[model samples]
Target: MKKIITKELVPGMVLADAVLTPKSNILFEKGTILTQKDIAKLTFYSIDEVLVHDNEIGEIMTISSLPDGQITASERIKQTKEFQIFKADFEKCAEKFKNEISDLVAGNKEFDYKRLLAPIYELLQKGQTNSAVFEMLNNLRNYDDATYTHCINVALASNILAQWLRWSKEEIETATLSGLFHDIGKLAIPEDIITKPGKLTSSEYSIVKTHPQKGFDVLKNVTISIHVKNAALMHHERCDGTGYPGGLKAPQIDRYAKLVSITDVYDAMTSARYYRAPLCPFIAISMFEEDLQKYDTEMMLCFLENIVNTYMLNTVLLNTGEVGEIVFINRNYLSRPTIKIKNDYIDLSKCPGVYIQEIL
Candidate 1:
């Protein structure tokens, strides 16, 4: 084993002993393989040195052990009767939501706010928490890039976040509605531009950017809550003032808009786009961490912390290919939690090159 300076350590070196935070908390356990992300965690915690073995795992092995069911965790979840029922409910509700959004945008009449929320209510009836909803959605997917699917996904996530915040039922309704129509303006954008598989031109992008205003314009005259209208207009507005339609900062942004902003980006990232596959939740977590400055930090931290907490006791696949069950979460690194593989527990925060590749 070698005691390597934290700054100089490279990926693939396995830990020789458990690394710890300055408070002496176990950070990374012995046998954890190094990853670039783990190294960054080291820097974040001000750790100077770690003990690692000299030899590498050699070509990086991925260990998948599902011999019992002969299927993946997600696949197993899908085979359940509950999931089938949920799938039917989800499809029926999404179609209903699509029609509701169309009617709302077309000014056909004052639509029932309760009707707009039926999709989320339907999905919520299946699971007790947002975590369970995420589990079902993450594994079951055929409409990754659908606008209606995106809206429903956002509403569901927003409701979860609001509940996590302990918001009132009325407040939750506003949040759910905010998410449901956050992109109603997109309906105004031609289907050709909205569904374009190729890179969008500058003009096309500008047209797309008008969505928030268009959404706000429709909601403005309607009898919806002001917060919902603001969310429609400002969901893309960043805390650091980098967003579009209006270059507003944290204080200038509406509270509900802030919540919707985070969920909007999260669902979008985890949903598949035409150009790329859906990102793993951990990947989305890491990206959130990287852009922490742009979001409402307090809410973002709460969002990340709770999202990671939902994975407790879940089996996960590590970047190094090891299969393990999540055992603990370090508040400092929501994307890198402790895992139990075989007979041992590995706190991923101490292992620089390792991370959750998939929530199996």
Candidate 2:
């Protein structure tokens, strides 16, 4: 059930719980199918919000197209009370985590790992599946949000991937924390370069690369899990030994760090920026498919397959200016799903130049 404002209520939404007057008299009973008059009565009494069955919310919002033929799953998820709560909680986590990082950098605070995990766990309590969570995160990825939002995104995505990989409960928690703290070194970098809107000069880029080691320096002194420390240091390391700081190969890199690396790149690449909108997940997955050698092969393939399938039945915008629904994921090319446009179907791999531009 989702608790949405009375203003957003529409006829045909079934109440999951009873609506009551201020003095607690029943105005409507549970399981009542709402009508336009019911909605007006709700607003007349100034009932702020009410719980509606999940399936009744916009008739499972993602499955129904709008009047103009737009079916944005992210937008649908945005209308849920779950998304509103998640967004507020996520912002709180980011702000708190950012302050904690500053405190860590100043050597004035003890790490509170459990406290940090609390919000993410509460978000999990909202009962959104992995794919639904992704849609919510995608919706929340606005340019004006705090930069610390990326850390939480990585943490959430890494947690989901860890769960998919069947990691132990302990390992999943560690992975989540590792993701949350992976980029702590960025705190030491100048805000100008971190927020720079243009391409970084070689010198600026070189300075930015120092964050890994800088992150390691702060973490090494803390009494945290070794996996988390390694995640901070080696998340950028590649399987092919081309990544920086240590240039460590797969075997030399920490396993947890390897897991975080995949999510790190996913969120970083898909996240909105000042110069460009966020890339579609399909585009990011395609990028990963093209560079599988750069990450842990097993994890990368697992992620690629897992993420690609999550978009099954999703409405998508093609680069050719047409919109379609993802009906199949090509096993050979995980990024190239078969799309259905009205009565026609196009296999993206067969149509070489076609690609998904956005999820709508």
Candidate 3:
């Protein structure tokens, strides 16, 4: 069995796994044959994906058009409540972890690896799918205290990227932990500069740039893999010899650092900042495209495929005030995807007049 986005769902396919409603009730049993009506039913439930026999997935010749109206008021409420649950739990974990790390650094004590990683592992497992984790990240913008939350968000993104890259279990764990500790040096920066509502002076900016090296110093004595330690030091290093500290080129940068750098930029750009408000994910993608030399293109492409393309079945509002569901991604242009608006499949890449205003 293989999981596929609902946009790719077609009639005559058999469900390899049971389809459950958002309320956890079984809507369709495993091995059940899917028809147009069943497909519509799943769409109405805001079901994103389903598992089908691997052989059956690619056998469909046509994709039946379905109107988009998946989310209900109740589902919105449920999603909000779900976000709250995750928010509460994340806050608790962040607080405890932050305190523990502070104590570990201040007292020169050994890192409590088990205690430090358990909550993160639990959170990752709780989300289950990459889409669910990204959804949680989108909802997290509703809360404050971005410092601790940013660490958690980056770690989640890093782990997801690691999984997408098909890394080993130990490598994934190290990458996740490395993301959590990447910005540890920021803790040493003065609170006023860290949270400054306005532009910083040249000296302050220079201090801010020292975070990577300072973070490396903090983790130098810690009992973690060298890759993990290097992640803290090199995450800011760019591919074209333009990053920070040593300004190492692509070949000089560590592989783990390259992976973490993508996620770090993604979360940092999408998250609200003291200098400016958060940009939309699409805007962030455009930013990456504008400055391709500053990142690992291969890793960035994989991240876009995993993180951005997961919104395949999402409803979006266009600049023309029309609503549509994203049906396909344009391989040549990741941001300008094909949208299904009623009976028409509008390819944004070809249509120069209209653009997506927001993802509904």
Best by lDDT: 1
> In model 1, which regions exceed 4 Å deviation?
1-65
Of 1 and 2, the candidate ahead on TM-score is 1
| Model 1 C-alpha lDDT per residue in residues 81-173, reported as the tens digit of each score | 878887788778788888777887787647777766766787887965678887787765664467888888788889989988889999988
Best by TM-score: 1
Q: Mind sharing the TM-score for model 2?
A: 0.78
Clash counts per candidate, in order, are 9, 1, 0
How big is the positional error of residue 229 in model 3, measured in Å on the Cα after superposition? 1.1
Please write out the lDDT profile of model 3 over residues 34-105, one tens digit for every residue: 744456456545587899987664233232322486663224634676667776778888897788877755
Q: What TM-score against the true fold does each predicted structure earn?
A: 0.80, 0.78, 0.76
Report lDDT (CA) for all predictions.
Answer: 0.81, 0.80, 0.76
